[model samples]
Target: MRNKKQRIAAMCAVLAKNPNKLYSLNYFQEMFSAAKSSISEDAAVIKQAFEDVGIGRIETVAGAHGGIRYIPSMPQAARVLLLKELTEKMTDTSRILPGGYMYIADLFCTPYYVDGMAQIMAEWFVGARADFIVTVETKGIPLAMSVARILNLPLAIARRESKLTDGSVFSINYLSGSSRRLQTMSLSKRMIREGTRALVIDDFIAGGGTVKAICDMLGEFMIEVVGIAAAIVNRYPQKKRISGYRAIFELEELSETKIEISAC
Candidate 1:
């Protein structure tokens, strides 16, 4: 049997996973079959626990759209510490490519590091009050999923072509990476509700062209862009930052060899 404190902690964690939804006390009560007063008191305990941890916050909103929201409140000290750690890992030449770009794929998929990156990005987004996560197909999905899990929200993928997403809607073409070939991408317009709050992300950024196209479509839905992030970035490709967005890695061409990296 779960103790009251344990139950409370679990409840808070659930709400923390997804702070945007309206979770009624009735819902909790029914799940636990506890009284309303007991559930409310448990919530209080959970609230205090979050405060002590100092990563994020929980707030209760009332009526229709009313529910608790977990706001990640990272102090400057924490951000500095995290950045220091991330930079240290980034500095290792072993992770660097001969082409000048740091090959941090191993680091990105690492349990601990990806969790750290997710927290750093989550804290940043929660602070900015972002609501949705957006990304293109393939590599970006996993990272986006991590962020969405922390935020407890849904992710929108701009597909390369019409997938079996059901009820096909629309498609767009944009230059992919450094290639001259125009590639088609898609999204079920119905899948996206109006006024979505998007925080765009990618696995690699060589130019702002793809990001811009994604943003342009988001504009049609009147969504607000929270920010942007990338696992790696090739800075010299376009020599232009997509004004108002921030990238995580600044890539350089170090060495290009056809060395077969060991498969995971």
Candidate 2:
């Protein structure tokens, strides 16, 4: 016998834990021992409160099979603030590595930064309705995994070395724009389901060769790449092989003990 306020609080907690999961009105009604109309009212109140605080939104489905689901979407202003914080972190001079490469491994290692990246990317690709997330091995795994967790989608990784132990794997070779050399990338055959739409993600894109190679591999499995995302994109001399990808930060300039970056 939960009261009105108690029921509403419970509903918000449940929805927050299970974002994108559909829950029938009857399900909540039985759990709370409340009427359908009462449950709906509780949801409405929670929905408005969530929207007002920039937490997310509650969606109601009308059909017999439909019910309600919570979407963990962030507002534009919050997203912009997050990117601004990241830009300041990227401008640190100590993070610059040899060969003019900026090291951002520290940022990716933190849950706060990675989770914020996931939220921003989820907001960006919400309309795309991507089925799953794809990324190359090593640095991109954190961002890819975070996005997959937030979006409730599976993640597939593309490895640079083909694993014979994992059975038959698909491999492809592409020209690395930075090194100006050919590089081979591979992935497990069973990772991605055929005919599914994929969103590709990467940590940094200098010339987009790695992501381009991942897309080329996806073609073999008939997976439609809906969109691509990166945490950072470097401003380099050569043009990127792949286009239409979004990033959180752009490397505007790099010099000895100097680094410049801005939000993308």
Strongest candidate by lDDT? 2
Best of the candidates, TM-score:
2
Q: lDDT tens digits, residues 1-264, model 2?
A: 548988887888888877777899999999988899999888899889989988888889999998998988877787788888888888989888899777888888889899889888887887788898998888879889988887778898888887877577888988988898988887878887788899998989999888888888888779899999998888774478988989888888998789999886
Per-residue lDDT tens digits of candidate 1, residues 186-217? 87876677876888877767777788788878
At residue 105, give the lDDT of candidate 1: 68
Angstrom error of the Cα, residue 219, model 1: value is 3.0
Residue 171 CA displacement from its true place in model 2, Å = 1.3
Badly placed stretches (over 4 Å) of model 1 are: 1-3, 16-21, 64-69, 72-82, 98-102, 127-131, 164-169, 176-181, 220-224, 231-241, 249-264
In order, candidate lDDTs are 0.69, 0.86
Assess every candidate by TM-score.
Answer: 0.74, 0.93
Candidate 1 lDDT for residue 166: 39
Clashes of each: 10, 0
